[model samples]
Target chain A: MQLLNNRSAQLRAPGKRVSRARVAVVRAAKTADGPRVAIVGVTGAVGQEFLTVLKERNFPYSDLKLLASARSAGQKQEFEGHTYTVQELTENSFKDVDIALFSAGGSISKKFGPVAVKDGAIVVDNSSAYRMTEGVPLVIPEVNPEAMSHIKVGKGGAIIANPNCSTIIALMAVTPLHRLATVKRMCVSTYQAASGAGAAAMEELRQQTRDVLDGKPAQPKIFPLQYAFNLFSHNSGMDVELGYNEEEMKLVKETRKIWSFPSVRITATCVRVPVMRAHAESINLEFENDISEAAALEALAAFPGVSIINDRQNNRFPTPLDATTKDNVFVGRVRRDISRDDNKGLDLFVCGDQIKKGAALNAVQIAELLLK
Target chain B: MQLLNNRSAQLRAPGKRVSRARVAVVRAAKTADGPRVAIVGVTGAVGQEFLTVLKERNFPYSDLKLLASARSAGQKQEFEGHTYTVQELTENSFKDVDIALFSAGGSISKKFGPVAVKDGAIVVDNSSAYRMTEGVPLVIPEVNPEAMSHIKVGKGGAIIANPNCSTIIALMAVTPLHRLATVKRMCVSTYQAASGAGAAAMEELRQQTRDVLDGKPAQPKIFPLQYAFNLFSHNSGMDVELGYNEEEMKLVKETRKIWSFPSVRITATCVRVPVMRAHAESINLEFENDISEAAALEALAAFPGVSIINDRQNNRFPTPLDATTKDNVFVGRVRRDISRDDNKGLDLFVCGDQIKKGAALNAVQIAELLLK
Candidate 1:
């Protein structure tokens, strides 16, 4: 697999299309036939990216079905050089479907996930509906593909949960190190982007920015507070007693489920920044065993789907724009934590496209694993 | 002092001038006499802010002199309803000056600081030049006024250093809690603003953002990387050997000096965000003694130059816009650290104006202490 860190500059170019052959690692061919695929929430930010990622990875699908709510039904979407009208999603929509990608929302996933699974589709859910379910395999394909190894295409119906965006992005960089030195505690502070809410949130940011620049008052519609040239705490519901927002708790709870390490302590502070697409995180990790900076960087460089940009001489580290629309999670500022007296702590800064690796691509990767 | 958290909404209002009488805590008036004051780097961001803050706080000045580099020497600046020409900063610029506020840069402070002191001018240097210098008191008036008790107007000449902006903002919230429970370890991640770099960087952000909105490429000038809708690690010089930038190290080293406790373990990841003028930080602390959320909030509320906006019910915490051009450091998301099972850990989000409290207001407050 090619180390895609050098392509980071090209990825930031506006309207530039990336070639999948150069970006995605070629998977071993299993059967000569591809599965029938269905994408739930075909009009959402993550749902739209699912098509792009599938087309980019050259995922073979015998029949592609675009599913959305009634409001978005009949919408025309172009995918793989073909235009398809989105169909209203229902229980009977998953007939003979081999793979189903769900990203509408947690409520929709909760109502329709089992319905689609009962119809014999291997449902790869992007929502939080089944993520913490005991039997559901919450997976980041690069980190833990074996969790869902029992399920395969054309087999009995199964639901594989994709971890939350913050969890996926953080684990993309931390899991490699966790394997080297057991992670004892993790502290993550996220600079999240506008796209995590939905496509409308991204549009709202663009429109609000224009209004603020023109000296017009920013109308807060999608968000409760002004978001133009400004940022706020994540709008997720908060556990008022615990003082932790749902977004922060998601990182804590989701990581424990994905890593299957319930004993590892984790805390996070998630805030929404005005950036368009990608999310950035400042992660501090404490390890059970001593790990040096050189050894950590060596392991990160060798990890698949991980790109490093630790250029201290130039002071160039990962930025959100560097990871916008990119496949790999960009990691930098890899250093031993000076706060710790021993080499048991490390600090890192990571950036990844929240809509891609955080949601769509991770779900698609799980779908790829099922094909095996 | 009246709690100003209620005025946070008005603070975010565009083009609204904050009335100082409603903002600043009333200090005791010494003598009828006022000091002869000079502002070094009067044309820069913090330099301009020093003029506003001085006027707002009603700092008594017998005569106000503006000093900058030769290029900005002839520029006229209006203050307190009078216009003054900026003079070229030199050894003779401080003649008969009782108080000199310096914000030009490190090199300018290094050279003119001693000159001003030799001329019997109390120099409040707002640079990193002498922050860690032994015997040179680094003060945040509310946090450590006693550090400069020996220096006074008309008594003798001395140079007092102001801590870094990130350090000042973080400590404004943390110091109060530290007083309650001794901090054994502190981890800070900053969402800094462009104003910290200087006025030019702020202008660059404005211009670049406009260009990007117009679909043109962002032309990076003040910063090497794209600054519009993007963030990067602090552009301060890096210590390649230690893998820490000079900005991050300043927080670690300056905190120990200000608190007069060198044993506290501190680590920081400083990143510049797209915000215009204010900085926000996510701070996690481990204390030697146990502290609760209610106890932490009580200490913070009682602390001067700090305001609490921890409304967990509304998920309305402090944003950078809430602290822009405000005197008080706005704090929110005050909660017990769920990462630790014990009550010894706490988490806080802090925001402060980089040019005001982080730079000018802090320097003026130190000058206020000197007035006594």
Candidate 2:
């Protein structure tokens, strides 16, 4: 499988259409009827990342359908050397598809997710639509694959929800430690990238930064605040009564659901930074039982899709650029909290591409588990 | 006093130098015999900010001395219609000085701060050199002017230390609430700006961002990592045994000294963001006594040099740019922490200019108290 990690890979011209021999590989698998794949919201950022992740993972697929809003219909997109015209997403779009990857916003997912499931196409939803819906499974494959084990691509269709990007990125690093220490409370402060707000926000950052650098005023269209070299609270709607924004609450709520620990206490401050791709979080955790730093490091090192970059002597912990376009969630600055006398408190920093593992790749991994 | 808020104020090309008639304001009465002033490390970011702040606040000075390292010694600086040649700093430089504003790095401050005091100059040091030193008062003028009341201009010389930037900014908003509710524990995560590192680091952020936008590799010179479109753990030397960096520990240690509360439990994680001149911090406080959100807001609004910008309905909160050259520390996202059911935990976000309110303006305010 070819791993695509940057703009160069995304913009690389197709090296001729896939040869007949390459297509034959799909014929050897039981699920290789490639569960006719359909990507809802194919014109969006995570929509684009879904295709990249699918191609990179070499997921067996036969026919592919690109679906988006009516406005984006008929747009030409090249995937794996084949040019496909986007079809406007509708109730009937998933009729014969065996698997569907939905990256449209929550309303679109809430409306179409069930429609797609009714058509027998297992849905791996990237939005938060059915995530907390009773009996609907929210899965981060590396963290909780068993959550959706009953749903198989060929046998039946069901909507498997993806956790929030920050939640997914954070749990990827902290869950391993949790398994060992039994985390009692968690506090997180996020340095989120502009991409988490979508492609337009990312472009706004680029344009605004360009203007700021050229000694011009920053005209913030996507965000109401200056975003070129400044940051603010997450733009999500605030729960005025609770004083927590939707993003912060998502981190708190989603972690509990994904970990199946309803009693866990969590607090988060989500702020939008001007970084282009990955998100970085500073997390401090209190455990029910004392866990040494070495034990936590050992656990994190063994966790799948979790990479450790804790270099203390050189002071090189994870940075967003190090995790940009990368698959693994990079964890660093791992150490015990000095404020706690008990060995139960620990702190760490995490960075992961919000588009990849946080959104697209996690949903794609869920699709893979459906095949298994 | 006129307050300058942006580059138009800082970068305004010098008009014709002021006439001799305009210079007589320094000859006015009171503290206007305006103790002769010496600005140490005048070529650096905070040092230059000291000059602007003094000019903006109408800080009275009879004669101004600009001092820097030998490399910057010959530079010409125009201040209040007078052009003064930068003088290479030496022990003898403070002989005629009544008040010295020091923003040179710690080593220089340690080496020269005492010398300036011995030479009968009251030194308002902006480095971390003597902040925690015994009998050397660490002050935030609004919060702890009493700590420096003993030192008066023209009476005797003394070294008064300015607290660390992050510590000063955090305490500006939190201390007011602490007075009302008695904070028991504080957990802070800072999004520090490039200017905290100095003028060269700010230039690096600009240059590297341009390079990254042009598809060129970010050439990291001032910072070891690519700071453009990214964030990293604070670069201060890490205490390997405690796993806390110098920046984080300074927040813990300095809070104790400035608040004069020895037993308060505090922890901090400091990360450097891409913003140019201001630092933003997300702070969570657990109080010993319950404090209502309205009460906290009331306290903050009534505090000097603390402004509230939390408009929950408009989703408008403080950003780094909003506080860039502003004297006030902007506080927002003020609310009770939902994760804590006890009404004792409150969360807020703060932004203050790293060079202005955090360092230079703070030092100048301390100097003002010295005059009183």
Candidate 3:
């Protein structure tokens, strides 16, 4: 795990230049008898977290290939007691890799993901790319582990997409209850963490906090304005009509795909907060069938990978602080949505570490599925 | 002026017990020419804000009386350059007073407010006590100025109630749009500041922030848990039927009352943020008729007390950092709510200094109606 521990290693190349000799050397070093893993855009935030997850989970890997853009070539990353050199991601980067974990931007995935699949590597993409594709499976291991079995790797390696971070956190709580009662409509507002924006944005929030506390002028380079002590609409570009940002749209679409409910009307307001990790969602759900708050709580408590933190009497429930650095999604503040008809609606507050359940952990879990 | 500066003076007595000689002293203090103002429960958070509002607005007063529970009696508070000792609040506290401002807990207002009215003082209550009362006018000056005209003196002096902080901030922006186009439904998620809870809660947040940043043990006092760098559902208690908490219910009820829309459906999720002053709301609204995003922006720009800050191209919008210390509510990220029917739905992000427009400023505005 030397690579995961070495935080100062330069993860990106100073310029865009690919070395054919390096790619050849790295390809020759890989072993076919052992687990072969390819990390696409390994310099990004989720990509870095993926490295940690693989190490922490003790994934059986004999050889790992670090892949990024041409500009990231020659950068070094260490994992599992071995230091791996980064290779410029090309059309054939996944030629002999057993598993390819993609967290590069959606556009990059859109352009290079299929090429990796054609190279006979199972692709677990952590971007919006291929998520809504008709045949592609968007999976949350806890919610849809069975979907991973449908992966076809003979003709073309299968691409498994991860759900949106906000959607994954919300659905981890809502899905269990939906099984007890069909969720008809849901309203969710996300208090998303800064890390969701990637490494540079996280650094910006950290620097801003330091500047504001020290009475120095704080310049927001990644965000539009000050985010040190404020909340704002999700930063994704605004949609033409519904005024929802691309982030909010991702939640709406991803939840439907994961839950297999294309007609379920989900309205979301995704807000970016100053918190460093974990995202919280305030949710109100309407069900087709009547359900009591107690019953909903029972269902949530029984669900896997979901913890019931709703103890209002003791003033205990989920908060972003409680969810950070943990893998489980926390659900609390269970009550009936009084504004709805009778007991047909329920209100819940949910929080989860976005870097874990929302990204790296899910991707790593999908890789484990390939081994099984 | 002495009273204004020494706003936290202790009340005079500890219980409801008042000597006849003390009553005589109170009677003799009333002047013939000066307007009489009664401060109900002059010991709480909103009660303190009312004192500042009076001083800042320089409300003309010949005499002032501070009234609170017997437990808080003998406490002194200064207003407008005069130090006034707290008197035991009773059914007779409003005798001969021209106007009374109530911010005590609801139970106290329910018991003493009607009695104050019977004694011939118009009451502007800051509690939930009279808000939903049949004849009680729930007022936000910018949204419903005419509601003040309904407050008449000596006809069992009518009681006017201030809307909830979240409701007031939302309506300040929504009222302008509703007037231009009929609003059918609203989905609001609030990121409320800790100050909305009161002075002690604000202090708790500050301490928690220091503790977290300094690597000290953080403790939760005013809140159920640590308040630094985290978010939680605003209401901790659950409802019997609809899992909505009392705070969420207030947003729904108060919005309908302020907008005078009995049939409009509103779903709200209120969460407490670590921020100190301004409260931010992510709103999704549907109109009866199709409305273009451009038209809505034009209407919002021309609307009074509303400022548009949406500049997605530059990543600028309303945030608590920008809203704090400001009087008017700031609205931005205005666009159509694409999650709903095309142009029929709109999404908006709004922020306002909760302690100002949400409380003190609105109270002062209501007091201005008294002069008119």
Candidate 4:
């Protein structure tokens, strides 16, 4: 635990060498009965979190391999009490690997995902490269584990895609209510964090904030605008014709694909806030049938991986920090939409750790489903 | 201009004494024909901004009076090349004042606003004290200036209330579209700034941020949660039964009142971000009649005190920083909501200076309206 704290501190100081003193010495017991797991892009933010989640969840594995881009290939990573050098990702990197977790950017996943699948590894991809692909099963374990039930470890080569972080976080809170009454439409506005952009962006936020406090002008490098004390529309590619940025479109398209309800109308506005890792979303839902706030709270309480913070008396609801480093998505402000006369509409505020439930943990849960 | 920048810098440093060097030298060339102006709660954020906005717009005033709570009384405030002591607000303060701008808390406004009006001074309130009061106009200058046309300078006393900051920012962008097509339903998610809470809260945010960056615990005094690198639901009183905060309900009720269309459905989720002064909103509108994106843009472009920043090719949209200290509200992301098949739904991102258009400047505009 102390070593983990030291390592976390070191992460904030970019360009610093990983000293031996900060290495986590806690080791997982290897079992021959378990599968051989390989983690692609082990040097990135979500990649490092994959290791933490796997260890915390005690995901059983007989052997583990870490792979990254050539630039990070020679770097040493300490995981499960073992120091392993990250290898350059290539077609041969997945040889004899039973389960592979991929979280590199889209292009890297696009180039290497098929190679791993063909090599008999079940690829659990955490990129946009395969999420919208027709044959790929975009899975959010709590919402739809059945989407990828056909793929299993040691069964055959296959690919299961993880939905976007924002989509995964939103559905975690909404899907439970959605189950009670079919959703006719959804409108989501996101207060996203720096982590969604990656480790470097988070560092930039910290450094820029420091500079600004010191009375120096904030230098923007990762984002086009000053991010120290400001928020802006998501820095995603724009769909000029549609007038929706790529991040907003992802929420629209991915929700339908995940819900398997193609006709469910959805719109989203994605903005990046100055928070560190967690993401908060304000969601408005119109249901096809009457779904009272009481019924929605009951459904959310029963749903696994969901927690309620709706204490209206105290005005204490979920903030980004409430969900930081937490597994379950935190939901609050559950109320019937007063705008509509019928009780078919609801409003919710949800927060979840962008790196945990939004990315690494959700992907790990998918891997767990594969075992079942 | 240099003096204004110096004052701005000094304002960020709370508990510090105001140096004479920061006082403005540019006088407003007061005319005897102009109205007598009194600013209530002159030590607060919006009250201080009232001075700046009045000077920038060159609103003619024969004489100026600064009033605040007893705690701030006797403090010297320099404006228009002269230093005057802030006086304690009292019944006698509005003896000869033609326009009294009230921005104190609701209690202060409730107590003194009537006193000012009864003293024959026209009160332009920047609190919820009289917003929903019968016959008291809830005015957003760009949206409903004529709501208070019955009252004029040197006429019998009347009170006009400024809508809440969030409502002011949202309606500025939505009213233009609503004019083109009557709005049936509206959903708003606000990214509010610290200024909405007042000057002390803004100071708390800055202090908390400095402490957080220095590795010390963020001691949240003005807010219940950490304000640095974090966002939270608005800290206003919540309605336990309705499950809406006072801030959110204000948006819903004030919009209906300002539009004079009591049946117009509106719901809002208000969250305070770490921004300094500007507020941003993601607004989704459902109109009674079809309104195309082009027509909506045309209406917005022709509207007064509105600016368009919809640069899709660059993914540029209205950001809080972009509207900071600006007189006009910035609107962007003008697109038809693909969620609805018809052209009746539209999504917009809007930002406005919470102190300027949302509070002080809007109140000033109301004072200007009385002249005509």
Q: What TM-score would chain A of each candidate receive against the reference chain A?
A: 0.91, 0.93, 0.88, 0.92
Write model 2 residue lDDT over A1-372, tens digit each, in one string: 111122124434567445675454323321335667889998999999998888778877766788999999989887664467788998888877888999999999989988988888898898888888878899999888998888887776788899999999999999999999898888899999998989999999999999999999999898988899999999999877777898998898888888999989898999999999899999989899999989999999999999999988889899999999999999998988877778899989999999999899999889888877
Where in model 4 is the C-alpha error above 4 Å?
A1-29, B1-28
- Model 1 chain A weakest 10-residue run by lDDT: A1-10
Q: After superposition, how far is residue A75 of candidate 3 from its true place, in Å?
A: 6.5
Query: Which residue pairs clash in candidate 1?
Result: none
User: What is the clash count for each candidate, in the order shown?
Assistant: 0, 0, 43, 0
Each candidate's fnat, listed in order, reads: 0.86, 0.77, 0.48, 0.89
Candidate 4 docks at the CAPRI level of medium
How good is the docking of model 1, as DockQ?
0.72
Cα lDDT tens digits for candidate 3, A238-263: 76444567888888888888888888
RMSD of 4: 6.4
Give Cα-based local distance difference scores for all models: 0.88, 0.87, 0.78, 0.89
Ranking by lDDT: 4, 1, 2, 3
lDDT per residue, candidate 4, B281-348, as tens digits? 99999999999989999999999999999999998898898999999999999999989999899999
Model 4: per-residue lDDT, tens digit, A282-345?
9999999999888999999999999999999889999999999999999999999999999899
Q: Give DockQ for candidates 1 onward, in order.
A: 0.72, 0.73, 0.35, 0.75
Instruction: Please say which candidate is ahead in TM-score: 2 or 3.
Output: 2
Interface RMSD of each: 0.6, 0.9, 2.6, 0.7
